[model samples]
Every structure is written in C-alpha cells, then in structure tokens.
Target: MSGNRLYLSVSLLLSVGYFWLGWSLMQPEPKHNFTPCLFKNVTGIACPSCGTTRSVLLITKGHLQEAALTNPLGLLAAIIMLTLPAWLLYDFFRREKTFYNNYSIAERFINKNKKIIIPITVSLMLGNWIWNICKGL
Candidate 1:
C-alpha cells in the first residue's frame, strides 16, 4: 500500500487497540487465563511478547518501572502507540507525508544494513524471550 494509506490504517488500528485496552481495564479481571498468545497456549512457554499487554497497561497507568520490568518492548510500543496517531493525523490534515518519508528512509536504511541489523534484531528478541522465560511471564 501507499505510505499515506498505510499510515492511516496503522493509526486507526492502533487507536482501536488502545481503546480496547482501556475498555478491558475498566472491567473486572477474568477468573481464568485468557491470554491471546497461541504460541504460549500450545507450548506452555512465555514468548518474547508474553508480558507486553501487562507492560503496556502498566505504562498507561504511569508505572514506568513496572512496565519496563514487565517487558522493555512495551515502552517502545507505548511510545509508538501514543505518539504515532497524533503525528499521522497532523500529517494527514496538512496534506504532508513527513512520517511516511521518514518511514521510507528508515526502511531503506534497515534494508541496506540488513546484514548488521537482522542479527542484532534477532539477538534482542532472543534476549527478550530468555528474560520472559526467566521471569515466569
């Protein structure tokens, strides 16, 4: 898809996700485990993203330390979820494509540096998975 459409679609999806998160928080916690992770369900092992939801919830509640302890990726996710929509909307209203342009630049950089970037990304994910397992997430 084109950059504008991609941005708009992502922004809307993220907004809806945030709204669902908020709504879930308002309800009472479920009695049984209702995790959304199929990998975890089948394997009985915490995936790299196991605690991300709890981490993001803690982040929304302003518990930065807890959120980080839960999952460092949540901090990154929170930053993107919180800021991206506003930036996308701003660009959309102004008929600008700065975010898309930057995204393209980043994509090109990552593609060019894949030999370096891919290994690092994989290592980080593996590290996170190890951390999650150790923490019994």
Candidate 2:
C-alpha cells in the first residue's frame, strides 16, 4: 500500500510482461497492416516506423544489412524498449538498491542525459526514415 511496495508490484508485473514479450519474439509474428503513417499512402515516403516490425523480423532472421536498410533505428528501439523491462525485473529480483538510491551513478546518468538523448534519437530515426524512403524500401 506504500509507494515502494506499489513500485515493487509494478516492477514485478512489468517483469512478467517483458518475459512474455521476449518469449513471443521467438514465435511467429502475425500478419497485420495498419500503418498510421500518411507517408506510406500519400507522398510514398517511408515513415520513421514504416518497416520497423519487418526490420526487427529481418534482424531476427540474421539479415543485418537488410534490417538496417529497412529501419536503422530498429536495433536501438529493440534494445531500449526490451532492456527497460528486463532491467526492471533485474532490479526487482536482485533487490538492486541502486535503482532506488538517488546516489546511484546509473540513475544519475539517465536523469542527466535523457533530455538531450531523446531529441538526438528522434532526429536519427527521422533521418533513417528519409534514407529508407530514398532507397525505395
């Protein structure tokens, strides 16, 4: 009922979800086409996330270059998104007090750099999108 307990519970839930998500990656992906990007249908430009899933699939299939051509940001997205939940789980299980301790250096690094890092990441993804479009992906 306290804040720390609540956080611990949420972390456990996220850990379970991440475990399932990671497990699902080993299974077959479903076919779906519901792109919200107008670039795909209008100007014929590939959007930043246009082939993200396909790129991830190709990466899983060992087509590294093809994946990069499809979405250069795919690996970055995959690592951050997937690793976040994994880290949450790790902290929950390991009782990593550093995650809670404000003095933790890793926490300090994230807090200090996230603002600048996000915009740079966004720009990179957008650049990759334009590149993919130019490549006729």
- Worst 10-residue lDDT window for candidate 1 reads 20-29
Error of 2 at 25 (Å): 7.5
lDDT of each: 0.88, 0.67
For model 2, the stretches where C-alpha displacement exceeds 4 angstroms are: 1-44, 97-122
| Model 1: per-residue Cα lDDT at residue 118 | 98
lDDT of 1 by residue, 20-39 (tens): 77886887867987778899
Best by lDDT: 1
lDDT of 2: 0.67
The estimated TM-scores of all candidates read 0.91, 0.55
Q: List the residue pairs that clash in candidate 1.
A: none
